[model samples]
Target chain A: MEILSLNQISPDQVVLLQWGVVRITATLLYTWVVMAILILVAILVGRKATADTAISRWQNLLEVVVSSIREQIREISQDEPDHYTAFIGTLFLFIGLSNLLLIVPGYVAPTSSLTTTAALAVCVFFAVPIYGISKNGLAYFKEYFQPTFIFFPFHVMGEFTRTLALMIRLFGNIMSHDKVIAILLAVTPLFFPIVMHALGLLIGMVQAYIFSILAMVYIASVTQAHESHGRGP
Target chain B: MHIDWFVFAAQIINFLILVALLKYFLYDRIVKAMDARQAGIASRMEEAERLRQEAGRHLQEMEEKKRQLDARVQEILNQAVRDAGAEKERLLALANEEAQESRRRWKETLAREREAFYDRLRLTSGEIIFSTIRRILGDMADAALEEHVVDTFVGRIRGMDEQAQELLRRSLDDSRSEVTLVSAFELRPDQQEKILSALGPFLSHDVTLRCEVRPELISGIELVSQGYRLAWSVQRHLETLEEAFKEALREELPEVNLENAGGEDAPAQEGSRQPHQSG
Candidate 1:
């Protein structure tokens, strides 16, 4: 457990699967753990969920969470929230659970590992085009050539660069927060490290929310592009 | 920076798996529940609105019924009042009619009673007057009254109106040539001679004289020939006196009344005989 190794930017992972040169890592294991927790809770809460006026405590909590995400999706999408709920909701949950696991001892946050963050960012990168294409068809590509054909390169580069930013932004924040806590604890061995870890928790949730919102914005921009041209949907 | 392509690929695969798993477990179920609850709330609100509209309609119907009931009640009350007023008027008219009939009946009864009382008084007065006069005349009668009556008849004949003289003459013609003289008492021969001499001028020729006494003629004399009745008797005088008294009684008792007093006029002996007839 090389917690304070500045030279190796990615955390040492406990591998889960390996085939010839390909490897599955511990970050994947932790992400799987988060996935299991989310899945199990969803199952129990889903059973508790009722269409009646009165509801159970679990159903009430889940309703609050689901509605809040629905409202956020509606604001960004400016369209129906039904189709986008799953994609945006899964992104927030995965990232939020990864940060939430920080309170457990010896738990390495999957978000704090570059490969894990890059993988999540890569999913968002692919999801934007998928959602945009699904909403507006091939016409969604017109937004890239907007203003002039001269803006085409900048628009194309902007997509990959934003994807890179999404990856680096999450990875840098979680990794640096973890490194600072590790350094504080290695030096002071106590209180300052605990405070910084708590701060890191807040930063982790903020980053997850930012990632989800950005993905939603990207999908909405493409879907709503024709509205600016006075074409009623 | 050390980059491992295999780990990166594995991490990306892991993330895609997480996205898929979470989407299936959490996002799908929760969103479906949320959509169902929204539909339920909308259904509940619509039901509440329907119930409220029904309640309003029911309230309006009730109000209309109440208004009709109130109007019916008022009509009944008005009819009752009208009937009562008409009944009161009919009853009052009946009472007034009954009162008038009773009053008229009472007046009739009173009038009949007054007439009966007057009839009894007249009968009693007649009897008393007749008896009283009979006694007075009986006491006064003798030959003097007869002589005076004979003189009055002679004087009446001398100054008679032509129509009366003719009437008396015609009556005398129709009879047998005889005259009858009645007296209350037996008369002397000389007295009869004087009466006969006094009446001789009115006779057409010689008239045979017949003398008779009637006790009812309490005083004076009466001469009868055919349909001519020349009388100056106490019975006839008494009748005249009773009539005078009845006239006086009628004047005094105007309200009580003695309506029928039979007073036939006497045949007067001209100017001299007028006093006796007037009495």
Candidate 2:
């Protein structure tokens, strides 16, 4: 192989840090900082929170944000508000922090990667019906071979396709927005980039909402399965 | 755009771990909180319903007690009114019975008083008549002196016509049409002599004289013919005067309770000495 010159090397660079047997990357360092900030803020604001009265300004703001997530969870749980409040609340916070990290100079949206979105989708796919099964027992699994024996193949394929669809949808939207901002910065380094960055911010928040709501919906759909046997999971 | 598989793979792992962590640590607590809230709301609603039912029961009890009190009060009032009515009726009945008994006693007392007055008048009139007749026939002790005079008068009256005798007998029989005659002595003529002289022609029979002293005929002779007698007496005039006095008393005594007045009016000896007989 011909050795390439310095001019030919890619602009991308990597710096690695090791702690014992573990290696931490620059990207992971950014992710950790974002996570740490989110956690500290969440805990400090929620320290003395109560259902009866507003605790503080920060606590009240956090409560408003959490209440919206709780509303979506309630909808996804289909009036079973007891099932998904905390799960969806945490999901919103994590993804929101990850998406907001994109505003930083060197950080990227974790959800912009196919692997990350796929992993999230897979967790949702497995967790949704698992909770459904746990809540309703083995009755959830029995709902898969619905309609008739001849329609079983179609139903099985549909489940795989739906989960794949969730992965692709989130990955595509976040990746495209990141790419568009990068491309705009390369073309013009001025006001155009600022608009694209703002758009990225908007899209990021929307994607977080969509993903968390969809996961909650998945959990709800399975719980409603036994009531409607003719429909597929 | 450039692709970075390693970064993508790490992110995918990170997202999966986060989702799982949240599901494990956070969801259970949130669900518990939500369930607790729901239970509290349900309990509050149940408590409210219980209080409302209790209030309704209390209200009904109060209403029932009020109704009972009102009915009891009304019953007492009605009983009192009925008792008052019965008392009024008893008093009225007693008053009416007492009034009727008093009226009967008053009428009996008045009749007794009238009979007693008439008896006293009759006794006084008899004494007057006996004294006056004795004075008028004084010194006629000869054996046929009064008989010769009566025979001469009776022969002259008998010699008249039979139609004249029947007229005299009719006049004597209708004593109410006789006029009063002026006489000093009280007359005590026999009813038989008067009848023989008055209707001798019509009877064509012998007549005899038998004197009878009647105090009711005080100053006039009474003539008798057939089954009738003609009478004129001072006692009759006194009876008219007593009738006038009784009429005046009746007119003046509209409000008097005369049934209780018997002890007041019996003090005079003249009023006490007479016999009482009521017609």
Candidate 3:
């Protein structure tokens, strides 16, 4: 029965190892597998992409999805989405794909564990500063010291807290939904678990949306101008 | 929170790989295609606009040409109308000239016809008067009238003015002159001698005297000495009356044949004939 919790939330399992002191976790393995799958599919679909006036239907689908992502990024940043498309679009694809992959029977959403959620949050945390420094030069740092120099420590806390909140929120929501389903499977073993699975899917998508939007807010706060940075409260 | 920093690093690597894959396969090509399609549509729109402008220019040119053609047509029509008016005027002038010339010719023909009619009337009147006088004098011819004509002729010779008598006297003095006496009636030898004796005073003594009796003289006696003549007859009296009538008619009519209406002319050619030879 605990095989249902066979996500990273389950007991430890490490296949790849380095000497006696080092080891790998299920979270890293699952992440690498999903990453490989995504990359392989992207490469295969990319082979059929057209550059001429008449485009393949597959290319059209890709264009619509990418353009939607660009439009979303533009709405969030209010500046040009030319540079931010890769990061934001990937953030959306990874989270959304990770949530959608949960439809597999024994598979766990990677965000169901705090370790993977923390990893994604950490990536956003580092990406915000790196993008800010690269785009606005010294102006990005000014947002941290805004209003007064005394607020610098508070700005630092806000950054850590927001990243922590993103990780915790995604972990709690996904984990609780899976836990609820697992418990329902034990107690009822019937219709409610199935019903909760559907609800959990809906919550998974919402949590992915929240996580990406929070990341966009953090990045927008630094790299984008104040007047243009109005999205993702 | 059972978290491993090592696994976090691995997940971050996984996320980066996913971003690179999605960007290469989806975002870059899709945006490029969209941009290409947009550029194509813009170029097509520009081409369409250019074609539209060209068509507009062509339409304007055609309209301008049509306007010019219309103006030319109007000018031609006006010119035609003007030519027609000029032709009408010319024709009218020609017709008027022809009408005027015709009227002048008619007037000339009428005047000529009136002159011919007047000439014929004069000729006819002369013939009528001559006929009537000849008939009247022919009806009055008798021996007594003949004796009276001789007496009157002798008395007329006796009553001659001095200048007339001297002209007669000069004629009789010429040696080449011969005295001739003619009568329309036959005269006896006694009458002939009497007529010759009566003319003896005007004639020279050596001048020969010739007496002739001719009924064609129409009751007149003609005595000629050189170029001088003296005679009296009923035909002569009637001729004198016809001359007076012709003079009266001459006052009423501008053209009358007075000379041809009287004297020696008669209806019958042989009814009277007289020739008096002097010189």
Estimated TM-score for each candidate: 0.59, 0.46, 0.57
Model 3, residue pairs in steric clash: B184-B215, B184-B217, B216-B272, B216-B273
lDDT of 2 by residue, B112-165 (tens): 787656644544454455445544544332325434433433554556566555
> Which residues of candidate 2, in runs, are more than 4 Å off?
A1-23, A230-233, B1-279
Supply DockQ values for each candidate: 0.37, 0.11, 0.43
Ranking by TM-score: 1, 3, 2
Clashes of each: 1, 1, 4
Best by lDDT: 1
Best by TM-score: 1
Q: What's the ranking of the predictions by lDDT, best on top?
A: 1, 3, 2
Q: Every model's Cα RMSD, please? A: 9.7, 16.5, 8.7
Kindly provide the TM-score of model 1 when superposed on the true structure, using C-alpha atoms. 0.59
Clashing pairs in 1: B156-B269
lDDT of 1 by residue, A51-142 (tens): 77788888788778878988999998788788888778878878887887787766778788877777777787888778778877787788
